[model samples]
Target: MYRDGAYVSEHVRPTTHAQIQPNGVDLTLDAIFEPLEPGRITRNDTEIGKRQRVASAELDRKVPETYYLEPGGYVVRYDEVVEIPEGHVGFVYPRSSLMRNGCMLDTAVWDAGYEGRGEGLLEVHHDIELERGARIAQLVFAEADHEGTYEGTYQGENYETPRD
Candidate 1:
């Protein structure tokens, strides 16, 4: 069975009441990056290619920065850190607003026990401007049986210690 939004919120950090949905929590955009080289995958190893951070523009100092993206592919990092609890698998889906605007986000299955501020591939089919911290995706969890928790290179990625 799928978990409710309130229950899923317990596993995400830096979240607000507004981000909690009926079925999941919304994830905001933290940053964007463009791939500069090709990545490689093999039976024994994998390597992510070089990427450059896409810069966002701020028209007014008081306003949030915005990215003027043309139709293309980019990598978007989520602002919140998530921890998938045991016996649950996490899935990140693009919000409908993105699709209405001609954009799509592709993500991988988040295995049980995965923890990180994860990333997703954003494919833009039309020109669009995205503001930093804009709601871009929803994270939901479903109950599942697993023999073990995830322990991979991406564990604890982009995690920072909280300040006192």
Candidate 2:
């Protein structure tokens, strides 16, 4: 049976051109998270541009895709949110097909109650420069019996279901 919210993506089924894959969800090259300066753009020759998160001030910095990921890089977008239940765990992996072709994404993990939006960070492997919004990899959500409390603070808040 289907857990969490039923598969309600633009296209229904396990996998699609832009849908999350069963084994792994595909990552589309689209809008990426912002990583800029706080107030005045910090000046530094070596430090081109990077993202920094501050909890005390609840501030973030975003920049454009100037620096690539090692051999290569990418800015990925998702069609759906990868949600999970409290005390459960999830994993974000690159689609095997994409790996074989070219480009890859960093392995992401979603804990219980991981909610925000279907978005993620991608690390391209090999080399295949493509336009933004291209399908990159796939995300895999598994059912794990991880008993933990979703409290306190972090990135945002772990996505919650069965109550939303």
Best by lDDT: 1
lDDT, each prediction = 0.92, 0.46
Give all TM-scores, in the order shown: 0.94, 0.50
> In each prediction, how many residue pairs overlap at the backbone (N, C-alpha, C within less than 3 A)?
0, 26
lDDT of 2: 0.46
Candidate 1 lDDT, 46-153, residue by residue in tens: 999999989876545426778989999999989999999999999999999999999999999999999988999999999998888899999999999999999998
Name model 1 segments beyond 4 Å from true. Answer: 58-62, 161-164
Clashes of 1: 0
**Cα deviation of 121, candidate 2, in Å:** 4.9
Candidate 2 residue 77 C-alpha distance from true site, Å: 5.0
Per-residue CA lDDT of model 2 for 1-164, tens digit only, reads: 22332232322222454454434455454344444644343454233246542111112322322222334343344534445555456666666666775656675566676554444555555644443445555545556676664442333432331111
What value does the lDDT take at residue 6 in candidate 1?
Answer: 98
